[model samples]
Target: MSKIKVGVIGCGSIAKHRHLPEYANNNNVEIIAVCDIVKERVSEIAKEYQAIAYTDYEELLANPEVDAVSVCTPNYLHAPISIAALQAGKHVLCEKPMATSIKDAEQMIEAAKESNKKLMIAHNQRFVPSHQKARQLIEKGEVGKIYSFRTAFGHGGPEGWSADGVNSWFFKKEQAYIGALGDLGVHKTDLLRFILGEEFTDVGAFVETSSKENADVDDTAVCVLKTESGIIGTLAASWSYVSKEDNSTIIYGENAILRLEDDPVNSLVVQYKNGEVVKYELGGIQTNDAGGQTNTQVIDQFVSALIENTEPVVNGEEGYKSLKVVLAALQSSETRQITSL
Candidate 1:
């Protein structure tokens, strides 16, 4: 099969760190074009991969040789760029949280349907080995019916990753829309849905900008979710965590309690009612890049879905569902009451 010609729409940290290298490694993909509002970054990445570069995404999308594009821009740009790419006859792999709102996400999905191009969201956590195992256990009834759960994804701040530190677009409400709830919180929201095979029906939340100085967005958020099946859970996401830990989901079932830790090594543990504990050692699920390119697996799956003519695990609608949960949390936080999904 001929390699799929791919273009990268944003030359930010995520594209530089995850998608670029992963596309280079995938034998079925060719990095043909790259675009960024900053010409220098696009040029640098394009040169590194021996591809063409553009300062505007429209120019890149107009290139007939580009078969697909990765939308790695900020939250606000996701919908517009993705819809444009779909209309341009290119498959789109959009970064997570899908979009800033359900309306925009729905528009992107409609565009993908109208264009008949594959639209996948970059929710890489669903591809983790531990997460995959946990999902299988849940599906097979190894844990029986789930009762309650908790999940969290926290970090110091985006200053370490953003180009402009505290002045980054991430801290700006206009660009990022929401803060930790959209950034780290969406991942857990998607993961919980994926693991439990249930959708959140209602949410109650508390959001605040506690640690980061002069930021307009929330730095920490805590939320309570009620699933459609009546399972209750809490989600906590923060950019103010002095020490980083992406600990997640403790699902209490009748037979066992399943715990998932998002660390690179020790990721899962299951405790039985009979005082027996089973541990799963996930030895570095990262792929081939700095910090092992943790998101590569999902990108690879997107490419494969196109090549093999199959549906992506995290398709546009699935992404929208996850975004709804986060959106509900945001509303609940603002209103100080439960919001129904």
Candidate 2:
């Protein structure tokens, strides 16, 4: 099997902790080039990965040896870089919140279509073992029909995560577009859609920058979402989880309630109205070393999709749809009115 020669744009924390490591670990992928505006970081990452270093992403994109690229740049740069990579005959594995706006997301999908390239969004939450099992159970009717759900993804601010630390682009409105909403909310947006097999039709949101200092973007947000099938739910994303991360969800159905990542020990639990309870000890979610968890399988899946000539589970259109929900929530917050998707 020919290895997929991969180039990574953005030598930031996410690229380092997730993309870079995961790609290197994948046997079918070879790190061909590393790009970042920060020359020092790019050079170091290139040396570590045994790949060439390029400060200009365009230069890296021009390399014919690169078969695919990971767009791990800021939210603002995702659309342009991914579209360009696709046009360059390279499959794209873009970090989530596909783009800052619905228009940009649509353009990205169109670009992939025109290029006949695979565009996979790195919404890693759906690959969580417990979340995967929960989806399977729900589809098998273990939860009957889902009536509602509440999902949240929260952690200490990006200061603790981004490579630039407290001064990261994540705190800048122009660069991040939307803070926790894009950084974390989009994961839940994608995860809920994947787990319930439903699309959100309406959103009412309350977005705020309540906790973080010296940050112009939102630190906390709560959105009420209704699916096409009348399943209503609350989606919350926050950067104010100083105590501990709260990445969990609860789904209420006609016969049972599924608690995903709600408990420390058991990753998933189902409570039945008939006095039966099932606990699942699925493995942990992907996180930084502080969380003592493994990285996500996103890079391997991207490589497989490209190699097999198959659409990734989270393809360009799927990403665009998930991003639409996030964009709708932001619009709802701005207009103080319910937004229809």
Candidate 3:
């Protein structure tokens, strides 16, 4: 196929700022269709992209012209919509969190396997240039063995990005499942796993809905995590930062300390124990919340995976592993104890 025909479900902030724009920018992708429950949203996107608009994703999935789909729906609809798209013989590029439940995640994976289609999760944090560079340095033993770390993502909340603003599905417990933990925490969990090259083994957390008086879901959370290799750290995700966004990670190692997305000018910085400091002015993480539409290296990679007949960077299994950490944190919060993954 000269170009992969694509359909995007859910005309939310992610779809508008990430998936649709990136796919449109990619030379190997063609926007075949778009779907969303909101007719105006879908129609506007369809007109902008010159694609068919559908009120139901199933109709778009049924179109044989669609070679793949980007599932950008709410957390609860992610699994079902993605499964339907995959079963319809179209590859799936699902948004983060994979699913709200393990059972649903497993089902989506099984469906993808059964259909022999690519299933990639849109975990863009791993695709950041600083993150990639940090991983490389760690692999080359530039940081020595990692000791502990603190990673966090915070912002004013989804009200700035969600299509419905303050009344979006993001604030609904039934649709979002978990709030900040699912929205932002999952990215940190996945990022730690990618850079550290390990799986989380246990988690203890305090997930709460302390912000947004009207929301039933968690607006803030702090998690203490332990990796399989005995590495321990804390992960914080909150929607109460009231000011600028904070998407930073600091990893302490035996030789040096690696900081990512933490500086005003540098993207990655290393401070050695021997009084040497290194700073890399690579670039900033894609701040979709700030109205940037730069390619996230997520959409094009999914397209490349389809064209090359290869697995995506963050596949179903990888997504599930990351998601399990968040799930465990929720359980830990409720039980007031550490929960093993």
Q: Which predicted model would earn the best lDDT?
A: 3
Overall lDDT per candidate, in order of appearance: 0.87, 0.91, 0.93
lDDT of 3 by residue, 159-259 (tens): 98787889988889999998999999999999999999999999999998888887999999999999989999999999988988999999999999999
Q: In each prediction, how many residue pairs overlap at the backbone (N, C-alpha, C within less than 3 A)?
A: 0, 0, 0
> lDDT by residue for model 1 over 1-341, one digit each (tens)?
89999999888877888888888888999999999898787888889999998998999999999999999998999999999999999999999879998899999999989998999999987887788888999899989988999888887878777656677888888999989888889988999999999898999999999998868989999999999989998999998877655556688898898878744556788899899988899744443223555554877898899998888889999999999988888888888899998
After superposing candidate 3 on the true structure, give the runs of residues whose Cα lies further than 4 Å from its correct spot.
none
Q: List the residue pairs that clash in candidate 3.
A: none
Screening candidate 2 with a backbone cut-off below 3 angstroms (N, C-alpha, C), the clashing residue pairs are none
Evaluated against the true structure, the overall lDDT of model 3 is: 0.93
Model 2 lDDT tens row, 203-286: 999999999987899999999999999999999999998877899999999999999989988999999989899999987776
Count backbone overlaps in model 3.
Answer: 0
TM-score of 1: 0.96
Local distance difference test, candidate 2: 0.91
